[model samples]
Target: MSLREAVAALVSDGDLVAIEGFGHLVPVAAAHEIIRQGRSDLTLARMSCDVTVDQLIAAGCVSTLISSFVGNSSAGSLHELRRRVEHDDPAPLRLEEYSHGGMVARYTAGASRLPFAAINSYRGSDLPTLNPEIRTVTDPYGSGDIYVVPALRPDVSIIHAQRADEHGNVQAWGILGIQTEAAFAADRVIVTVEEIVDDDVIRSDPNRTIIPAHAVTAVVECPWGAFPHAVQGYYDRDDAFARRWSELARNPHEMHVWLDANIRGTSDFDAHLELVGHPRDGRLNVTEAFPSPVNYGGRR
Candidate 1:
């Protein structure tokens, strides 16, 4: 089956989904399509950095979110998310925050199918303030400040890569992280790729292969897969939109309007492309209308 179909199949109401990517690379397009289909009561778990989270929130597809941070660049200040969670309304959103390392560790534990993972990172810290479930326990073996991290297996894991074969062998260009762990831990795995290369390409560089075919349930070819975001040699980050999102996030109503115009209103990537012109040469020109921090290292 196609990656899109696989992703769509795995998604059900109230399923916890995990996505792999950092900032603007290796996001699962197929999974986003599934989200676009409007499955209700979905929870998303993310490790550290991703722009897609904002897209999901803007879509109103996410009911609960567990992540280390949420912002334009790197956890770009989750202003809107905070508002939804903190609001004293009929139903407030649920949010669970974790440290970057803590998220990694949880996924790692889940992937390993272990009862729990031990870590000293949160010792003597207020991490429990964000998540009361985390408990500190004394280790009989004297392992030094071991905290039990519950396993985090998700209903599905969606990941993106530079290349993949028909059989689902994936080749990531750089920066392999908890992706493999998440894939292993999830009940289903869906992958999106820039190209469907021949098996020989993967066979030639066996060592470079990160996700083998058997672990992948679906693969789709999505060129410029990480549009408006970084895609290694193909393109840089989408600074203009990132800045606009950061600003809009500050205002809930403004964010809704922006989402309605640029994201939800659009059907496909082409529509998004029409709204935001292609990058000139290798860079995107930032206009005064979308003001960004001077140090913002987005598209530039």
Candidate 2:
């Protein structure tokens, strides 16, 4: 399915959507598509919220954020996020703040099909004071108090990968975030890849298969899905564009104009890719410098 189709079919208003990526491979394209489709009152979940979340917030596509940290990766503060939280310019963004571990624990519990996961992340902090859900769980073995958080089962999760087969078997390299857990925890998973390869190629190196095909609901071949943010071995992060977006996001008129030209104005993902000036001439290709290919076929 196309990126637009995948999001339209899987996501709806008032849905909890998780777009997982650590540093790179953030599903900005999927988020843009959601905005273009005019989704509203969405609760977005991310371990580390960055420009993508900021864009959605500016576009009025998100009303709540389930986040550990909300800011730009390199830049200090995401303009729109700050504007909404501080000024409530567009709308008041209801935030569910958590530690990085708290966010991860939520997904882990959901992936494991458990009610909640306990961690010692928010014990000493003031997070519990602000958010009442952060509670203490007594250890059954008579240990000390530990904090527990409810599982985050998102209505839909969109994950971008280096590559995937048509069947939706995703394989990604570089910094691995909690994407595997996020995909498993969501009710529906959309795996958007730079390219869709043959199953034979995907299975040749099984170690790269993070999310299997069975867990995926939709597969979209969206090249440059993670533009502006790097995709591991693919392109380098577009710092110029990121800086421009940060500046434009500070003003509502400028931000909307940028979104209209780049996101809403574009007809499709490919068109947006073209609009952003992403080159397909092997400029973002990855090279395997390491020559070793080990096989622990039968160590036991």
Highest TM-score model number:
2
Estimate, for each residue in 93-161, the C-alpha lDDT of model 2 and write its tens digit.
898999898999999999999999998867679999988878888899899788899999999999999
* Residue-by-residue lDDT tens digits, candidate 1, 1-300: 554466567777888988877754556355457545776678888875345676676567788888887666642665666566667222456778788888888898998998677777786779876697576677888765567778899998888787889999988765566778888888888887878998887876676677888888777787766776766545667767667667767876786676677655767544655666755444743332322324324464
Please report how far candidate 1 places residue 205 from its true position, in Å.
1.2
Off by over 4 Å in 1: 1-4, 74-76, 88-91, 138-145, 279-300
Clashing pairs in 2: none
Per candidate, the number of residue pairs that clash is: 5, 0
Candidate 1 local lDDT, residue 186:
89
Off by more than 4 A, model 2: 281-291, 296-300
